[model samples]
Target chain A: MSEVTAPMAGKVIDVKVNVGDTVSEDDELIILEAMKMEMPLVAPTSGTVKEIKCKKGDSVGADDVLVVIE
Target chain B: MLDMVMTTGVVHLTVGNLIMWLIAFFFIYLAITKNYEPLLLVPIGFGILIVNLPLTYLMQEGEGLLWKFYHYGLEWEVIPPLIFLGLGALTDFGPMIANPKTLILGAGAQFGVYVAFFGALILGFKIPEACSIGIIGGADGPTTIFTTVHLAPHLLGATAVAAYSYMSLVPIIQPPIMRLLTTEKERKIKMRQLRPVSKKEKILFPLVTVMVICLIVPASAPLMAMFMLGNLFKECGVVKRLSDAASNELMNIVTILLGISVGATMSAEHFLKPEVILVFIMGLIAFAFSTAAGILLAKFMNLFFKEKINPLIGSAGVSAVPMAARVSQVVGSKADPKNYLLMHAMGPNVAGVIGTVVAAGVFIALAG
Candidate 1:
């Protein structure tokens, strides 16, 4: 499965799923706050999480593969 | 006994009317061809066509359909509040919430509003007239009309037309100033990522801000309340119908009335004055300064932050709404396909809208 990445650089405000959670396409898994706005990082496809690269309060960049769904 | 006659009423439409028609035609053409803010310009252009025909009963002392709409819809202050409702519906407060610092950029963008207001005062306009004209710098349509009708009723025509006309030309007016102020290297700067905000935070923000802003500037309460209310509806996730109306049918109806009313303000006697020229020139200056202010503020922020901010997004802080925000992103993407600054720019972009409303309140308080 492909990695779901961040759309922009921002602080990780929240991670909706714990490690080992199953997800599907368009399921919001993370919230990144940029420009004083909350942008959700939705799963690109259905997958089981193999990794969660960041946590709450972590900063991330665009296309930084946020979660690995296997 | 003898009767002398000018050209037949229909044929009496002279070269001046023809020239005005050409102006309307060009505005329509630009709006259609260039894909600028056509939603506004196309209607305003059509209004120019209808009203500028010398002896047309459209704007005579009696009831003309448009004149009736203009008098009741805009003059009585009906459409602006509703337009604000629509705007509030469409506005996303996320960027402002996520990057609270961008509010500074929004505040900075209002420098032009005051600067232009002062410019108008120095040009012999009275305080109220100056205030209305000055708001053109905010780059917002309803704010321009609201301030003008309330403060300097006479200059309403020039101020409104200039505000909308320049808005439709933002893509053209902003780029040159952006180029003039920044080096290509600076334009290409990649900004740091923003923090995440919870849905709870999103839901609470508008509520808290309403108290803060309305308390600070009571005159701003109407526009600000309408604005925050729209965001509230959008965020609460329970009132989808209200959000849909605010963004669509309500906004569309208000826009139609607002555009024509503002366009109706542009009559030859009112629009052909030397002050009108001043309004136009001050508009360009206001746009340039707002862009500069946004860039400079972002540059200032870069000193404390580890990852540099893309200063280009600062230029979007003027209240051109999503257009300015989109421009920031497009400019960034041109430098690096990987870069997307639209949402980042929107933080200040939306903030600029509120800031301008606050600034308008300041003017109304002082000028009134």
Candidate 2:
């Protein structure tokens, strides 16, 4: 399993995938808003989504695991 | 006695005072109606109005509020460095670190500083005066004020106003030069996405930059050191309150005092001179040359690189913060609406700030 992390501390404004969904590398997984900029978090590898650890409106810290891919 | 009392204030007014009133009104108009740097021009405009009034003693040698502000805040070299602290706190070094090559573009833009320096000398300005005037090309007002106060205090009024005026006019002054220097294809070139800069790198950049710059040019340590400290405050994550104060409360108070003090220096006898006119003219040339030099250097660099950089970003090398960079984006979008050049342009834009400081350091070291 590969865990995708938040690059910075921010509020997750969107979640674009669900568990059991197939995803491609670099696909947008979440939209994080921080420092007045909207940053799209992307998948690090192509895999099936095994878990979603963050949700819309969740405040996340830098390096916090947001998704699990297998 | 009754007649004299009625006309006392009225009798003190002169043609020069009236003319200065008009100029001050024009600045206020620009600030209120045209929305040009109101944060600066408004206070400065009001200060000009107060000082131009005859016999008020509002700007008297040692007694007036405005004079005190000027002497304590600017002449003593306190406010400009504080302003840099705020600027550093607000600045993000991510883009510059992501693409370090833009530092060269920033250096290339300093071509304007030398152009204006030589131009001022040929026009009969003394060396120190010319040095202050040339820095108007850098398009960074705090640095301009800092340099002028140290080197040529008398020209402070004209140089500060000229630096800021040209800075606000970046959208107007830079586009023509950018267009004149580059081809359509060059303007349309799309740069690759910048890689993300790690947080560790961001934390180290200010410390390493301060050490390197101070070692190379000790004259810049005061300004650069404060700037780096502010950035460190912001990046450290533990000093959120200090960073907030630097960017907000402290910045606001210093800006108000600095603006009014800069305006107070523009007494009629001091401001209405042939040299002042020459300074304004030199300021225009400085902006033009800075923009052209950045674009030319980018074009020159393209000869060596496999992937071409959109040369419009070069015009952003003048250090007017996001304004010059925004102008680059607007012009690039005109050429190709799909182009997203803002982030790419920011690399050079921020670098221009450091470049201007280094250039000022060189001037102080060599000339002062």
Candidate 3:
């Protein structure tokens, strides 16, 4: 499993994928908010969402884990 | 007879050139006293004064090194792109990635380029020159300089002054246009927070942006390549020191030299023509149109969503960076102090930079 990390410093605006949901490469995993813009965290490869790391409204730092993609 | 050789051909400065000196002084005063964009204006102002001193050896072959810098650097298009590299180091794509929708706002703002292009055309300016002059509306300094140096070399002085002047006056020029276009209720519309991007995404962003831009606008490769190189140095996280130097020291040095070099282009022989007045007028028109296009795009975006977005942020699509973003905040605050749109404005503001670059590519393809 590979960990999907926050790309930048921002608040979590939304979680698009849920744990156990199968996803394809480049599918958005969660929404990270920064600079008043929404950044989507996407899957690295086709995989199932194994674990959700952060909740909505949580402030995530650069490189902070958002989800585990397996 | 020996002294006559030295006295002869001591060229007298003309009234037109003297008038150029006065205008240059105005910018110098604005930069020093009013604290206008001193970084660019002060040196540029001085350059104008020094270069215009009739028969002065400042920019001439035997005058001084200033002319060499202008000829070898600006004329050759070496300096402006390097300046862009510094700007790229300073820019944070976070705002853009957070709200990729703002990319459209950036694109929308560039409608002014075409609008101004035709405006210049209607004013009896030819296509290539008009296209170069029209680009000043994009409000991107490097792009303006780049286009002028290539498409309309003679118009460089007027176009650069207009671009930087309007950029400094952004606080003044934009508010009235923004206010007249939107109702108070529309100004208060607040947007929701942007989503988070992944670390891998940040790492890949500069690379991807470069690839996309290069494939789409190969003419802008030099600009895009240098810009992305700086961004990569910044986002890579492993090169903080290099990023710091590039963003600060390197940029500062280049700006000083480039400002003076740009100012040197304002020789009266070229700048005092009747066409210069028209170029100045067209620059303002371009700026206004870009801002209007942003507001209109915001209204368009509002149609799709129930939660209204602040249309004022749309004007930040003019690519002046934090200045445009600050204009958004100022306008938002006057409506309601709690309505801080600075961050929200940044998304499109950054995108505006990209938008301007893309617009430059279009001109380079069509005009270059």
Report the lDDT tens digits of candidate 1 across residue range A1-70: 7787787677999999978998876787887776565656677788888899999999997668888888
Q: List residue ranges in candidate 1 displaced over 4 A.
A: A1-70, B1-8, B11-15
- Candidate 3: misplaced stretches above 4 Å? A1-70, B1-11, B61-64
Q: Worst ten-residue run, lDDT, model 2 chain B?
A: B333-342
Model number with the top TM-score: 2
Error of 3 at B283 (Å): 0.5
**Clash count for each candidate, listed in order shown:** 21, 0, 20
Please identify which of the two predictions, 1 or 3, would achieve the higher lDDT against the true structure: 3
Q: Quick one: best lDDT, which candidate?
A: 2
Question: Tens digits of per-residue lDDT for model 2 on B43-77?
Answer: 99988889988768878879998889999999889
Interface RMSD of 1: 6.1
**Clashes by residue pair, model 2:** none
Find the candidate with the highest DockQ and give its number: 1
* Worst 10-residue lDDT window, candidate 3 chain B: B4-13
- lDDT ranking from best to worst? 2, 3, 1
Q: TM-score-based ranking, best first?
A: 2, 3, 1
TM-score of each: 0.82, 0.85, 0.82
